[model samples]
Target chain A: AQSVTQLDSHVSVSEGTPVLLRCNYSSSYSPSLFWYVQHPNKGLQLLLKYTSAATLVKGINGFEAEFKKSETSFHLTKPSAHMSDAAEYFCVVSESGKLVFGAGTILRVKS
Target chain B: EPEVTQTPSHQVTQMGQEVILRCVPISNHLYFYWYRQILGQKVEFLVSFYNNEISEKSEIFDDQFSVERPDGSNFTLKIRSTKLEDSAMYFCASSFGQETQYFGPGTRLLVL
Candidate 1:
């Protein structure tokens, strides 16, 4: 069985400042990880994904995440936060081709 | 940029009434799915479909819930009877095999 844990339920970041949302996973096999963003009342948008290919994955809207195997973490990051970046973030893992999502992290960007 | 599309962006229903949510996945996509989010909760997988049959389903997809690809370009989820707890945002998603899944905006069902 595979599961994901988002370290924080909420995070606040100042506009133009750096943003970091932490996530860790537990899986029996080498897992596939993904990040999704959902704006208010909208569906989830795939941010990025880490297959067995790249350790550092780059996503849309200038976001990226590093797949750290030893630490069991796949934290999302962005160098500069924008008001449009304010939304809920979800860390997900895939096992047996099934996607299981974590309790999302709400990100608030303030100017 | 083709994506999954869902119907009835918002639906209000009474307890014990049946509600059906609809979806149209991207053309050529072979896999379809339904997921739900109770306000402030993690997205829960309800069911996955392929080849005109259910590929996988979670515990939450009880007897009250059923999925059908009754026609081309249409996939539907039918709730046999509604409960107050059933009020939530239901999302329809599709994917090409094991790759990333594209999601629909969701139908906000409010059971009153």
Candidate 2:
């Protein structure tokens, strides 16, 4: 079994400020972790993924996430937030070819 | 970049009516999937398809739900009878294998 938990239901950040969204996972096998962002009325866009590759993965739109095995965590981060960054973020894990998505974290960026 | 495409961006239906959602997965991709998210809920997997047959399905994929790759390029999900609880955003996705899956914009189904 594999599952992901997003720590925050909602997070607010001012434009140009740093952003962080936390996530943790539980998996029986080596996990494939992913971060996806969904803008309003839009489909999910893949942010980044960890498939036993680089521990620190970089994604589109200046976002990145670090996969920590000891902590059982894969937290998404951005050096600075933009108004366009407002969206819902999901942390997902793969199990037996099925994706298990976490309760999403909504990111609200204010100017 | 190749992407998954779905039809009927929004559909409203009456209870007990049948609704079919359609999708076209990325070309050359071998795996296809359907997922749904109720308002404010996590995205839940409904089913996965490969080789013209269902490879995996979730508990939510009951007898009322069926998937078909009727043609070489298109996949469809048919609900035998729509329920109020069935109102949700349904998404279609495709992947090369067990790798990252690309999602479609989704069909917002509203059952009254």
Question: Which candidate should be chosen as best, given DockQ against the real structure?
Answer: 2
Runs in model 2 lying further than 4 Å from the true structure? none
What tier of docking accuracy does candidate 2 attain? high
* lDDT of each residue in B1-112, candidate 1, tens digit only: 9989999999999999999999999888999999999987889889999999998999999999999998889999999999999999999999888678888999999999
Q: What tens-digit string does per-residue lDDT give for candidate 2 at A11-47?
A: 9999999999999999876799999999999998999
Residue A96 miss distance in model 1 (angstroms): 2.1
All candidates: DockQ: 0.80, 0.90
The best candidate in terms of TM-score: 2
Q: How close to the true structure is residue B86 of candidate 1, measured as C-alpha lDDT?
A: 94
lDDT of 1 at B67: 99
TM-score of 1: 0.98
In order of appearance, the predictions have TM-scores of 0.98, 0.99
| lDDT, candidate 1, at A74 | 98
Q: Could you give the fnat of all candidates in order?
A: 0.74, 0.83
